[model samples]
Target: MVGQRQFDERRTLDRAREVFWLKGYGATSMQDLASASGVLRGSLYNAYRDKETLFLRVFDDYAEQFLADAAQALAQPVVDQALRAFFDFTITSMTTGVPTRGCLTTKTAIDTKADGERIRAALRDLLDKMERLVHERLSTGEARSRLAIPPAEAARVLITMTRGIVVMERVYQDPERLRATAAALIDALLTPVDPGRRSQTG
Candidate 1:
């Protein structure tokens, strides 16, 4: 059985995560956290010491779980299929829920500042991991002559495009359009060189 302290901490952390995810780091206040966490303000301070520190804890937990799930989903052997799944997951995860809070990293990229360097660094690390996984997937595609661009270049393009897509979805609130955009991106990345153009150039 979970000890009371451990259980209380977990509950507080999860509540804080939800509040931050929905409202963002800068906007979430101490009272907001205390209310959402169902802990008294005094007890909240005693447990977490301060709001920013509690936020960091919540952000770290969210990032860890998000990356783990993403890594598994992007691990499909086929590059095209894996990318399609990635886009689908990204869209659904960001758009389907109420309030439509986008990816936490994507939100932080827009909302955070120098004061939140820890969160920013963690997000950068996650993006780097994403790029590495995409590079590997593209490398496999390149081996089969399904990709013309260098895997490294394509990986960078894909990760950047994904970030853009996530941001755009928040403003547009159109899932179909975002899905199409992601699909086009994958198609462009995987499109082979035209044989006629190659022949003429050769």
Candidate 2:
């Protein structure tokens, strides 16, 4: 019985996550959550206590999955391959599956106010992890003479560019344009330091 309850809870959370993703937290009501998750309001309240608690739980699940995907991208043998994996994931998130859903982290960050300090902090930590992953990749790339700029700087720029791209996706929603931008950004970042070095050789 306990196992079945747990499974049902997760299934409901999955549905809730989708609802929250599609509609921001401020806009999602208890009734909406109940309808979307196909779980009774009484059960949801009994399980999660309130809307804020359930939203946080759903956010936790989203963050965990997002970081796990990042870990996979970072696990690639080559830095360029790792970066490509990261960009691919970002592009897919912005354009495919869930349309017009720029990013949960971004949406939450933009929508939340002083009351959402905890959520903001959690989002910052996740972004830091992403930046660190890029930094680590660039550190390795630097050793191979693949980068002209400092690893830290490159990572910062990449993170900034990625965030910008994510925002732009909400307005533009053009996959090819975003892909071109990503390709250009990668090319610029991977360019070698030496004047004589025309390509990424190593």
Candidate 3:
């Protein structure tokens, strides 16, 4: 059986993550965490040492969940299918049901202070992992003919495009716009490479 103190600590961290996810690190206060976590301020301090430490725990949890979802999306049978699943997951998660806190990493990236730097670094690590997943899925020989450009370049472009879509969806709240943009991106991905078009025939 878990000790009372340990159970309370876990509960506090879970509630703290929700608060941080909703309000962001810069905006959230210790009072807010204490209230949201349903724990007294003294106990929160005892468990986490401080707000920064608590926020780091929340950030770690967020990164783990995001990467796990991405991994599942990338696990489809084919690269193009995997890419589509990945984008679809992002769109559906952002738009479906009640609007929850949007991407926590994107929310925290603009702060640029100490905690912000930590959050940004974590986000970069997540992006790097995502890019690697994309490269692996696309590097399969069967995926070659479907791609207009090299797998590495396409992965970079696709990831950038997907991130951009998330930003737009966060701001605009237009599902159709997001869907259209994603379709256009997929069309571009499906376009055939044209090396000959770059040459000066005249």
Tell me the spans in candidate 3 whose CA falls farther than 4 Å from its real position. 1-6, 112-116, 191-202
What is the full ranking by lDDT, best candidate first? 2, 1, 3
Residue-level lDDT of model 3, residues 1-202, one tens digit each, is: 4324744666777888777777777888889998897888877777777787788887787678777898899889756577778888777766654665666666676655535555567778878887888888888875777788898998899888877876898789886798788777767876543457426432
Please give, for residues 58-173, the per-residue lDDT of candidate 2 as tens digits. 88888888888887876787667778788888878867565566787777777753147677777788889888878877787443477767888888898888788878888888
Models 1 onward score TM values of 0.84, 0.85, 0.82
lDDT of each: 0.78, 0.78, 0.75
Model 1 C-alpha lDDT per residue in residues 9-110, reported as the tens digit of each score: 887888887888788878888899889988888777776678777877777788678767777777776677778887787788788568787877787778
Clashing pairs in 1: none
Q: RMSD of each candidate?
A: 5.0, 3.3, 6.3
What TM-score does prediction 1 earn?
Answer: 0.84
Query: Model 2 misses residue 56 by how many Å?
Result: 1.6
TM-score of 2: 0.85
